[model samples]
Target: MAAAPPPPSCCLVALPPHAKDGLVVFGKNSARPRDEVQEVVYFPAADHEPESKVECTYISVDQVPKTHAIVISRPAWLWGAEMGANDQG
Candidate 1:
């Protein structure tokens, strides 16, 4: 059988404002630890559908702060939708 994907690490940390809501933060990993930033956003549930009102937005790493902590907001929700860690679907 093929190997299963590894469980997510505990290093995930969400930022202050949205942390209490279960948001997670992610950064780049290098040979030595260094700070890198990226942002992936999700719209309201109703907007997820093709004809929904919500507009999906993808903010590239260059748009956000390099050291700023991003809010993953809903990891399980993303996974449930079949969107892997690096996927935004």
Candidate 2:
């Protein structure tokens, strides 16, 4: 039988406002199948599809900048993103 995937791990650190050209770095390792790994982009948008606005279902339109950009690491078998970072950071 195949082995189970490893649990997730994450870390976040805040940078000083004066910091320039700073690098936001983190390491992630997953034992999931290679075919399931995928890179995805999450552009902030409104959640108008649902009849009733679900609480915390998505990022609010106002919270996102006009040029906001987000890059995410996702697993194809999962319904949501595993981790991501935004340009503003």
Could you say which candidate leads in lDDT? Answer: 2
lDDT, model 2, position 54: 27
**lDDT tens digits by residue: candidate 2, 1-89:** 99988466545454554345675445566555767757675766343443343233344233322334667777765544677777676
RMSD of every prediction = 13.9, 8.5
- Cα-based lDDT for every prediction: 0.36, 0.57
Over the stretch 45-84, how does candidate 1's per-residue lDDT look in tens digits? 2213333332234322222222222234333322222222
Q: What is the lDDT of residue 87 in candidate 2?
A: 68
RMSD of 2: 8.5
Question: Model 2: residues >4 Å from true position, as ranges?
Answer: 1-20, 47-69, 86-88
